[model samples]
Target chain A: MRTFSRNNLSFIILMLLPALLLVTIFVYYPSIATLISSFTNENLRIPSSGKFVWFLNYTQLLMKPEFWQVTGRSLLIVACTLPLEILIGFLIALLLNENFPGRGIVRALVILPWILPPVVNGFLWNWLLNGEFGALNGLMYQFGLIDKYVFWLQHPSAQIFWTVIVQTWTRFAFPMIILLAGLQSIPQELHEAAAIDGANRIQQLFKVTIPLLTPSLAVAIMVEFISAFQIFDIVWTLTAGGNVGQVINPYTKTLMVFNYQMVFRDMKIGMGSALSYLIMMMSMIVGVFILRNLYNRGVDK
Target chain B: MKTIMKKSVRYLLLYTGAFVALIWALAPIYWIIVSSISTRTELLSKPYKHWIPTHPTLQNFIDVFTTGQKYRAGGTLPTSELLISGLRNSMVISVSVAVLVTIVALLAGYVFARMKFQLKDPVFFYIMLLMPLPIWVSLVSLYFMMTRLGLTDSNLGLILILGTMALPLAVLLMATFIRDLPYEIEEAAFIDGASRWQTLWLVIFPLVLPGASSAFLVSFLNTWNAYMIPMIFSNTEKSQTITVVLSLFIGQYEVAWEQMAAATVFVMIPPILLALFFQRYLVRGLSMGAVKG
Candidate 1:
């Protein structure tokens, strides 16, 4: 490494200026402001100046039934979707790791849902779930699976279930691709070793493949859960109500949606900021835990 | 003969699994394309529902582009000027944000990869911390800040907002890419007395162009697909993006499934094309952050 000379210092300062300035002006400043404002009583609709009311917003959130419901719904979606996504992702990764005809095209096609804009993905699924003239209904009716069209988005529980499906559809490719990379990196000699020891395919998979895949799998799960927790656009386009829309059904909304509702519908900026902080707090706890785990693993190595 | 039969059966099962996977991935897309091409009559008819449109038309695409027409359910096509302006706004913001983010992130990433500087680890740590904070957390204060600065409903505001969101990942990815480059090349440039700035632009930049371009592409797609920033930052046609408009279509009095599908295809084409072309860089860059961090 180059020593810290005057010229080197100046160059570093000059090069880092644009990024640092932007991050500060836009990200750091706003985040700090949100943190500070979260403590006060601020309302967007009424013009009264906010006065300091420490912990009130957080306490109110704790007291609110809707808040608990939204938090629970967020966890439920993650719990339901993450495992299926990981399992399917692992299966697809295993499949793709093998040599097959047109495998390249299949790999590209699998990523299509992930690449498409969330709003577009949401709308595509919304159309598929439409009660009046949905493709799912058409196919189901053709196959004699259902006698009538299903209103998939009208009810709260129904909305929650379909939203999880749409999210899983669009997002599973992330884990699949990452895990595929992980699988490919495992040395072929290990499989040879297992075969020499009379270990069959299933045994090799359980003993060799999975243990080797733990690191990437952990990374994939952490990344997936984090992104899923903050999901907004897909849910927004899929089931959020119209402007001046009524209170969101308790079953269907996530923390981000509740955050939006408080800010826009309830016009409670302080509570909204508080909710944002809570979301950040949850993300930070998980993020820090993952980082610590990675750090410990690195140290062990 | 028995071995041959077993092999054939295995191939059949493999192909069957592949076929199921393909259908799972492509069915929704095919349905959208089918909807985009079908007319109101075919879209509603039960017999036409299960099969491809016998009479396909590009009227929806043409309408979306030329007349700003959006399909409405059980109603005549409505000319949506918002669609046109939103496309324009989205393109402008996405392109500008991409360029700006690439330049900024490359600079910072280059320094971090190569330089020995004070507070380096701390600065990088700060940026990494910013990564996990969701956009909604920042939206409240960003709205306040942008409105206070009178940058609301403007292209520049949207660019700043989205650019900030894209910076951390781009920088991290770029830094990793640059770090992997051959160090001797930069050393040779330095020995020739190219100076630091000249070395970065002339020597290092071209070597990392592929990495930088991928960074630009990812940043562009992220900004293009962003909904919350544009939804809150820009209220009018002058600044609203494709995503905001597409979402509003859902809440419209008459939802035009065909036109919505058409507009969706239009909005998705650029990113899809970019993703296809830059698949190599994207796969590497995306997984790098996950595995490395």
Candidate 2:
């Protein structure tokens, strides 16, 4: 190994400074600032009152029924979509992993939703759910499934349903790609060996394939969970603060929407920062747990 | 005969699954395209045939590009100048961020991968922790900071904000690619008495050019599509992005669906083209991040 001289050490430090400075300024500094501000009365309007209040924001936020309800909706959305994404993503991955004509086209199409600008995805769904000109309602009417336009976004449950549908549409491709790569990485001989031992396809999938794909599954789960938790764009454009903001419908409000409403709409910068820290902690805890298992599985090895 | 029957059944299931996946992915996109081409009357008609519009026309496209007239079911409405500036702003910000990220990530990634230094492991861990850390946590603080610095509503500010947003992942991605470079090449360069900087520039950087380009494309797509930051900071037409402008097209009284779809088509073109062009790199990049994690 070449010995590292003082000059070389300085050179490495110099090269690393830009990234370090940027991250420190933007990522670390802001993150620490959020933690610090969460404890204070750092209102955007009342900068003079930005005093350290010592857990007051946290306590107050926890006590807000409105906040809890939004949190519940966020969880509900994630719970509904996580399993569906995993199962759907796995099935698609299995399909794409197979050898067939037009497989490339199919793969590209599958990832298209993931690749498109998410704001556009939200808008596309908005148009599709429009009561007057929505393709969905029109299709239903043409098929004699409904007698009239449903005004899907007006109803709370329907809003949640449509939001989750659009979320699934856009996000499932990520897990699919990850899981498909995982499936491809698995050695073919393991399946052959299972086959030689009189295992059926389903049995082989359960015994060999799933166990081997666990790491990928963990990754998919982590990505899906974090994304679903932070889902804003789809809900924002689809319902705009949800049915609650529109018609006092309560079910469609999520933490992300709730935060936006609080910070920008409500102008409660201190409380919003507190909520942001809360969200960050929740995601970090779950992320740490999943990543620990992923590393423990020795998957990266 | 039994095995043959089972094989055929399996193939049938596979094809059916593939078909469903394709339709599920493409249906919304197809609907928007159809909506963009069809007139408002056609779209609102009872039991509208959405698969293929009865009167397919390019008028919506023409309106979006030339006249800024939003074709609505009610009438032709004037499109805001925000749409034009939004596209221009998005292009400038995305390109600048991509270029900035590419250069910064390359240099930092090289140092992290090749250098031996104190506190390297901890710094690296902190950087990696940022990969999944949500940006909303910092948004409130960042907004206040930007406002104080007089950086709000400016292209430079947005670029800085967006570039930093993308930096963590970019660094990790570049480091992975650089770390994978053959050790012997660098060793040979060192043995030939090339300095460390000389070796990186002459030997390592050239080898990792593909990785640099991947970083560039990824950063471009991300910053280009970013919604919340631009929505928060760039409230004016001068700096609003395509995503923000498109969201505004959905007005309170009536939504101009056809024109929104037309604008949607325009907004998607850059990322789609980039993705198609860099298809292989994208796949490899995604898989590398996944597997390495």
Candidate 3:
């Protein structure tokens, strides 16, 4: 610290001040403002009088029919994706981590879905699920499996199903990578020691691998859950039509997407701000829940 | 016999799992490559949808770049001046935001990591807590903030929003990576009269370039795919981005499935190719959790 010259200190200070100021104004201040907005009826215009409405927004959100339904649907998708992603991700990561042939290629190939832009995921799935021209039907036809091309994104059930699969595809590679790191970090000797004591592979996995992987798995679940809950693009891409409420719950469309619709489509700035605040609060609750649950496990250890 | 049977089942399960994941991973990509090379008639062709094009061509790619004003019908992709400007605007915003965010986060990250400031622990947790909300929510409020400040419809307004959006993750990540840096190296630099900026630029920056790179890439991806923020603040021809232009595919009356797909593939390529090259870093970065810092 003593070696730093005044010029050097000032230069670094100058480099950082603009960014810090930006964060304060844009990030921090707005965050506080959102908390305030959630309680009021502030719309397209900011308050002329700093009007404060109590828990009106939160209470209104609770009564909205679209709200609970969307939460349920979001939960359904998260429920479906989380365990399978963990199990499938764990097994696949294990195989790829094995000192086997073409391991590097396998690792690289598995991560392909992660790098594509979110919009592309939307478009690619759009083509695959295209009723007439989609590749999915083509592949099924090639195998003589189906006589007709299914309009996968048209039917509500099919739409939700495809959205889950697409979202899972885009996300699973992420958890796999994390769990693999956790797996590889564990020393091989633990398994060897357990095996010498007459434990079988199943026992070793249940007793050693699973417990050791718990912290990593917890982190993976937290990431997957938070991401899954806010999922928008896949849904928006699939049925950005009159279907937001008809096909799915209003909120399942994502707090962000809902904000877009409210602000841009409906042109209700106050309601949109209200929606954004709700989203921030919901995500914060989820985030805190994850931290408590996961870190508690660590603390228990 | 029992042991052999068990080994076979384990191998079978492993192979089955791997194959299923591989299919899920490959389908959309195969669709992208095939669609990129297909003709319009071929795309709309009948039964047994060609999984692979019978006659591969780069016509779609050419059409994407060359097609004049997106011929919007009742419902279709916006093929107007907005599209071209949107493309250029995306390139500018994503790259510039990535650079500005990365550079700023570098110093803040270093300070947070090495400076031993008060409330650092609480602040770091606060950043992590703030990370989960969809960025659009941030933009909705920020748009109002910008409007109040009279900064809407300007590129700098966007740069400011996107830069701040990138910082929390950048600072958190930069701090952790900097923590792992050998304190001795900085001490050596200091003892040798290497000023703080000199040490940061010459020594620390090089050491944590990966963190910077990862942060920059995240910033780029956020700005690149961002739809809502840009849509609200820069709905004008001069300011909006590729995502908004593409969303025109969803306008109520018409849907341009083909051209929209074409537009999508165009915007999709740079980031996908970027991910392909940096997939290693991005994954490593994501897994670190600290990488988001």
Residues A113-229, candidate 3, lDDT per residue (tens digit)? Answer: 776666567667777777877787888877888888878776666667777777888888877887888888889999999999999989998999889988778778888887787
lDDT for A165 in candidate 2 is: 85
lDDT, each prediction: 0.80, 0.79, 0.69
Deviation in Å, model 1, residue B204 alpha carbon: 0.5
In candidate 2, stretches whose alpha carbon ends up further than 4 angstroms from where it belongs are A1-7, A45-48, A241-250, A289-301, B1-11, B69-80
The runs of at least 3 residues in candidate 1 whose Cα sits more than 4 Å from the true structure, single-residue gaps closed, are A1-7, A243-250, A290-301, B1-10, B47-50, B68-80, B291-293
Error of 2 at B66 (Å): 2.8
Per-prediction DockQ scores?
0.50, 0.50, 0.43
DockQ result, candidate 3:
0.43
Candidate 1, Cα interface RMSD: 3.6
Candidates ranked by lDDT, best first?
A: 1, 2, 3
Tell me, by TM-score, which candidate is best: 1
lDDT (Cα) of model 3:
0.69
Question: Where's the lowest-lDDT run of ten residues in candidate 2 chain B?
Answer: B69-78
Which is superior by lDDT, 1 or 3? 1
